[model samples]
Target: MLPPIPVLADYGISPTHGFLPDVLPLTRLPDPYYNKWEAIAANLQALILSKRLRGVVDRLPVLDTIGLEHDAEWRRAYSLLSFMAHGYIWSGDSPSDRLPPSIAVPLLKISEHLEVPPVATYAAVCLWNFKPLFMDEDIDNLENLATLSTFTGAIDESWFYLVSVAMEARGAPIIPLMLTAIAAAREADAATVTRCLHTFAERLDDLTTLLQRMHESCDPKIFYDRIRPFLAGSKNMADAGLPHGVIYEDGSGKEEYRQYSGGSNAQSSLIQFFDIVLGIEHRPTGEKRGRPQEQGEGHAPAPKHNFLLEMRKYMPGPHARFLNHVQSVANIREFVEEHRDDRPLCIAYDACLAMLRALRDKHIAIVTRYIVLPSKEVRTRSRSRSPEAVRRKINLATASRQQPPGIALDTRGDGKKDSLKGTGGTALISFLKQARDETGEPAVEAWAHRFMSRVIRTEGQGDFFAGKPEEGAGLQVASQTEEAVIPGLAASWTVDDDVGGICYY
Candidate 1:
């Protein structure tokens, strides 16, 4: 039914159970295989720190699965590949957008077998690596899902990953919900479509509500000060922190510092699924749409380089294709339009759109606090003061080894000149700006703007609608506005004229 919602079998403990991957067993590694990979990851981090990652990665022993027969071994392999790939791509003097064969080749083979991607992903960081205390129970039932292992072995790192795991668990039901809708749509069952839309809207609202729970245990101060810094990419991150890189400890007192972007929500499939299902078309940040007259002058496919979509390359292979299918069949609006005579279908569909828009709006708010304000403050002080003073302010040196677990070591002031250029390097601001632009007014205004625009076109035509809403009862449409950038933030934000949504600085 509906192609069984594609699954990457090798990556799952149960290949037939839809998109869920196996969680790491809540126990110790029974052999030396996992420990050996940890050592490799540690050494790779060292090579990255010395600016010699390519030479070593190119010479890495070909991946052998002699000891990788267990779930733990598979998880370790995923972790090892994630470290190697991230180091190769972002540890460069600048961010290398392309994956070199050194990291890509073995990673591709292993990931294809595991049903994941060749790069770091949410699956690598969260899904396949976590271990719940009770094997039979869900991870959300546990207070700690960090018993297995982590790249940096820091509590903050564990916390960062656990948030995603919790969110994934919360949103897991939507998979069946959407798939059921797809089946109903195929049969042209208006009643079934209406029911599914209403359920989908309720689920989306639940997801948005769950998103607010990020603040519950994941303290903002801890996240912004301790955790956020670890997740910074090397792209536009010179001014923020970790100018050279982060020193990862291997527990034997052999600490190795390497430049890395760490894990981020940019790689989250949950958000990507929302984009796919809602028909939210995203362009790369800073790229403007051509005018209507210039739309097809050359008929050449406009080059698209959206960073968010680029992150999909890092998703599990089957997972990425599932999103592709969802996008291809985004027919809720079309179905509703065809059933203009059916008030129930239109109301349910509009409610679904409103919920989706609200989710985007909530994300924009998060980006504002997590990226915009901090970057704005950091850049303002950097410009108004000397380099040394700026460094002192942002780089408050917490004790090196005494740092809490998951807290990344400060790698700045090593007399190393940062080779990456641009303001996004200083903080999360750059990535957040792009994310905000991607999620802003255009997506939020879809149903509201579209429904009104259609109504306007059919004006003076009696009964453009075969059915009307009950008196004083209709779809509640949220308003969109022009993109309003926070003052003095040095982000290259382009607001779409047709969409009205605010990206608060």
Candidate 2:
């Protein structure tokens, strides 16, 4: 039997079971600190509304309020820090990298206690911050995700977090599916492998379909202007306004900045799990200066500091290792290629890649409307005015106003304002382009070549599984390039580097 699917309990929700409300206690702690975190949230919101959130977060003794060290308290503390952190970092004309002690110290402590990254991670914002509308109801419902937040309460934030929640719930089954696929590959059971591949394809298709529903309730304008700001980090965001850095409110009066990317789906562990399991090799989307580094093991290119890859450092330790292990046992593509003679296996693998490609294509289309079009409209409107004309700004006072529910931003060719900043002001374009590039046709096309190309006819048995599993099964899966290096074919990181200059006043 396949080594018992690794326990996913540490991930807050177990992959083995349905997410009944009480099954996971993702709520605030009771008593003094409970009220304390609430008070902190209220104050943070007050500051945000007044546009005075900048340089003032450090004064809040956010950590001193913790009465106990329980998970609930940690959750509460995380919620507070997320609000304060984002506000302190992004409320200014530009984002800040250095976090003040009031926010950073307690945040680091609480995140350690909660076993998550110190930054505004998926765990801090989504996993730990949501509660079901009813005590007995499942949290998978979008309506059930009552976000206990400190910033502007918008449906866009709820929708972004819920999308991940829904994805985790739906993606739970795939963990076992992938594990079984590995076992089948070890047994050299071509039939079993093919069956697993077909199942994986169907699940991926379902996921792609689920992702398309993001537009159903989440308005693009609200998302770009209101929700996206809270999730942005200071790294690669010069265009968004911090050419240098924002000063901290701390009395130390020291300029502080750190190069760190912000919270995005790129940092989602669940998605990374899929990439690892599927052997999807993601190349960098930013340009490099020198010749490619010498090839590492398995013809894998030398590791580079890809912002997406770097986010792995922020994942929960167990989850990060889980990704590494899954990557170690990646065998579906190799197995399918080895059996190219079997048309069914080849077709099944191709179909899976197609679904993955389709998922990226759908995201690109969403970006085109949600980010690109509105941005282009903004740029066009700004251009029509005099060179000295002041660019339009996000009106936080009107942030609470709700858009018409269930309607996506109009994508008609007509040039209408949709509220998203143009490529010059927001990091949305770069982030979206990076995401789109990862899922672009080139990556899938490379896989297509490997799937359709003639299989090498070497009649030699090689040690497939890289390392011995703890189970003592001694079952050899297939050898991947290295631990985590999944190689992609011909793909360029930069489509065009010289797009625009940083937007600063």
Candidate 3:
């Protein structure tokens, strides 16, 4: 018999999408995507109430199960999180305000469990604290970069800024500011110098805040030690093989040393993002060839990037399977009651929030499996059992992980040129509009495949690939992305990337 990996197969990920995490499905959402999310929110709470569901940490005191199922604020936060993860906020004009006040409220509430005091403060801000300062940039042009920093206080709060100054010559204030902060902190005799753990704690607020926003996107295990700790920078990627650590204002090294940051091991894969989109690099059925290099150099092991897997420590079971579907987040009372005193409250919250955040992430994974993963296997029917084939699947998976990320290409092509149409972008929107307009779940999902294919091909193409369609395949490659196939166009379509596939006209 095959291992019970029924859900694992559902995580749509492969070389074409690169290391991109799964997207959540609010696609079942109603039209004007935001409204769809709102409707789903009502239904989500209904489902929770209907089932009388219990979160994994039912014993945690912070949670009040009595009213959670019907909580409006909680439901609102869940809807917004769904927006951030799955809802298409872009109205095709400028970058939509991703972090609304509604989002911020829950975000701060959730951060209690994330990082420690000062350090994680740096990480959370490093990732999100700068959003207000950076979001309004002219998407019409990339060169119109905004001023990087807009806050008062020392370099203590913003570490990535300092790092940028250390690295980028054009960026100023970071070095001079760091020097000034060090001087000030030293004069005051504050423990400006601390460990990476302290730094992570600082960012925990943002981390947990984001968690509360997502409610429970991640599995608990990953949220804590891996995701939140790293966000704080208390832990190095070398823990996952992080490259280095930053120097505090007081000239104290959090560690006697840090890896990947400034050492010989610095700037390594653990810190560098290895995009696994477009086409994944994998070994052939018989022999190995060129593969995407592992996270680090020659002999170093491949890094495990899934933060949720680490959070398994705190979660209960069947519970694991059941909670897999829920992401609104754990109530604080519940979190406190479950782990008890074995771990610090903030750290536990970080773990809790991470799991909540991961629900959206897993949603992305499912998309990759559905859309791009098939770009790999090229099969319609899913093979759940059969040991030999399962062994091959496992072998490929094992090899994909075991072998350095090879630039190996799986040859089973749909033979259709990659396009916006191939990407299902427009089709997705159409499907949402159609399903929402028609009403009834059965009617909506019935033609989902047809809608998905049309959208993937229509909206997914353009710059990610530029090639002519073979006769009838509907692909008309106007331009080929210079940036390799694995990190394909759709794969790299960030707000910054040009080939986002949105047709304004």
Clashes (backbone N, CA, C under 3 Å), per candidate, total 13, 1, 124
lDDT head-to-head 2 vs 3, winner: 2
Cα error, candidate 2, residue 98 (Å): 6.5
Local distance difference test values of all predictions, in order: 0.49, 0.53, 0.24
Give the candidate number with the greatest TM-score. 2
How do all the candidates rank in terms of lDDT, highest first?
A: 2, 1, 3
For model 3, how does the per-residue alpha-carbon lDDT over 1-505 read when each residue is reduced to its tens digit? 2122112224322122111112211222232423433443334333232332122112212222122222223323332332221111111111122223233233334332222121222222221222222334421121322222212222321332222211121111122222232233223322331222234233333322322322222232222211222122212221111123222222222323211111110111111111110011111112223443433111112323222122221121222232222111112222223334433443432332232223223333333432233222322222343434433321111211111222222233784333212121222222222322211111112243233224234433343567544563443333332221111111111111112111110
Off by over 4 Å in 3: 1-114, 117-454, 459-479, 484-505
Model 2 Cα shift for residue 231 (angstroms): 1.9
Q: What is the TM-score of each candidate against the true structure?
A: 0.61, 0.69, 0.20
Model 2: CA > 4 A from native: 1-13, 17-25, 42-46, 52-59, 62-68, 92-100, 112-117, 135-138, 246-256, 286-304, 385-505
Highest-lDDT candidate: 2
lDDT of 2 at 157: 65
Task: Please report the TM-score between candidate 1 and the true structure.
Answer: 0.61
The TM-score obtained by model 2 is 0.69
Q: Write the per-residue lDDT of candidate 1 for residues 420-495, one digit (tens) a residue.
A: 2123222223444444444322322355556422312222223556455454333232123222222111112222
Cα RMSD of all models vs. native, in order, equals: 12.5, 14.8, 27.3
Model 2 residue 488 CA deviation (Å) reads 25
Model 2, residue 440: distance off in Å is: 9.0
Worst 10 residues of 1 by lDDT: 395-404
